[model samples]
Structure formats: structure tokens, C-alpha cells
Target: MKVTSAIIAAMCLVSLNLGYGAFYVLWSIADQAAVARSEAGGGFDPSQLLPYGNVMWVLAQLLLLAILVLDVVAIVLAIATWAGRRNVGRAAPSMPTAAPGR
Candidate 1:
């Protein structure tokens, strides 16, 4: 792939990671707060009402795994692009130019 394309791809990957990370942090905080408030109430334990919080946490972990995989792929692609550029720069000319007159 062209160097320009690779740069663009890297930028996009970084943007996506930042967006997902921000949202994940916000959601995690909100979820934790809700759990705390529920536990503090005098009524029955809130966990019993939402036993699936653990499941949700597991799902969130899977989302994190996906983001990590994407980051690794992006880094590898960027490195490959740099390697390709270096190889191209170092390669010797394959053919000599012909004379203007025979």
C-alpha cells in the first residue's frame, strides 16, 4: 500500500481507539456508581435484581480485547509500510537509460 494510505489508516485507527476508550471509561464509571447506589439502599441487595452485571462486565472485557487487537494490527501495518518505503529507497536501478542517438 502507498505510504499516504498507510498514514491515513493509522490516523483513523488512533481516532477510533480514542473514541471507544472515552465511551468505555464513561460507561464503566456510570455502571459502577449505579451498583454502589443500589447496594447502599436499605431494600434487598441490588445485585439480586441485576445478576447480569457480571455478564455485562465480561462483555465489556471482550470489547477491550477487540480494541487491543485493532491497535496491534494498526501498529503492524504502520511498521510494514515503513519497511516497504525503506526497501524502495535502497533498491538499485534495474535498467540503464538509453543514449539519445543510436
Candidate 2:
């Protein structure tokens, strides 16, 4: 139970980091696009931001996917952990009590 909980926590942390990375990449891409537009001075040629822009976009998408997968795994593990605890509690044998006047 403890181990499962630990694993879930780790996955959540990793997911958070991935989320931050994805956000940063997306923000960078938008900033770059804005700069390109401003530099164009009237005609914004998106082609000017070709391969590099595509690569960054792909990277951001992958990071987002990773975050989604990690979060799903963490949620599954948490549910399993809860079920395991519930089963253990139900299966545990209670001690017998003494008579009231004993």
C-alpha cells in the first residue's frame, strides 16, 4: 500500500513537471510567432518559422501527452490503493470482547 502510494505520488510530481515544460514550450512558440509577425512589418509569413516551429510544437504535444498518461496512471493506482485498503480492512479479523461482568 505504501509503495503504491509512493509510486502514485512520484507519477503526479512527474506529470506536474511535464505540464510546466509543455506550458513553457507553448509560450515560447507564441512569443516567437509574435516576434516574427512584428518583424514582417505588414505581411506575416508563417513559413519563415518553419522546421524549428514545427519541432517545438511537436515537443509540446508530446509533453502534454506524457502528462496525460502519467495522470491517468496515477489515478488508476490511487483507485487500486483505495480498493486494496478497503479489502484489507474488511478481511481483518476482530478480537473477541470479554463478558460485561467478567
Q: Enumerate clash totals for all models, in the order shown.
A: 0, 0
User: Model 1, stretches more than 4 Å misplaced?
Assistant: 47-52, 92-102
**Residue-level lDDT for 37 in candidate 2:** 70
lDDT of 1 by residue, 1-102 (tens): 575786787788888889878877887887877777777878757653445767877887898899899888877876886787789868676897798996
**For model 1, where is the 10-residue window of minimal lDDT?**
44-53
CA RMSD, predictions in order: 6.7, 7.4
Q: In lDDT terms, which candidate is top?
A: 1
lDDT of 2 by residue, 34-84 (tens): 667757777756555545766766777797787778778877987897788
Per-model TM values vs. the true structure: 0.68, 0.57
What lDDT score goes with residue 54 in model 2?
61
Cα lDDT, model 2, residue 97: 95
Model 1, residue 42: distance off in Å is 2.9
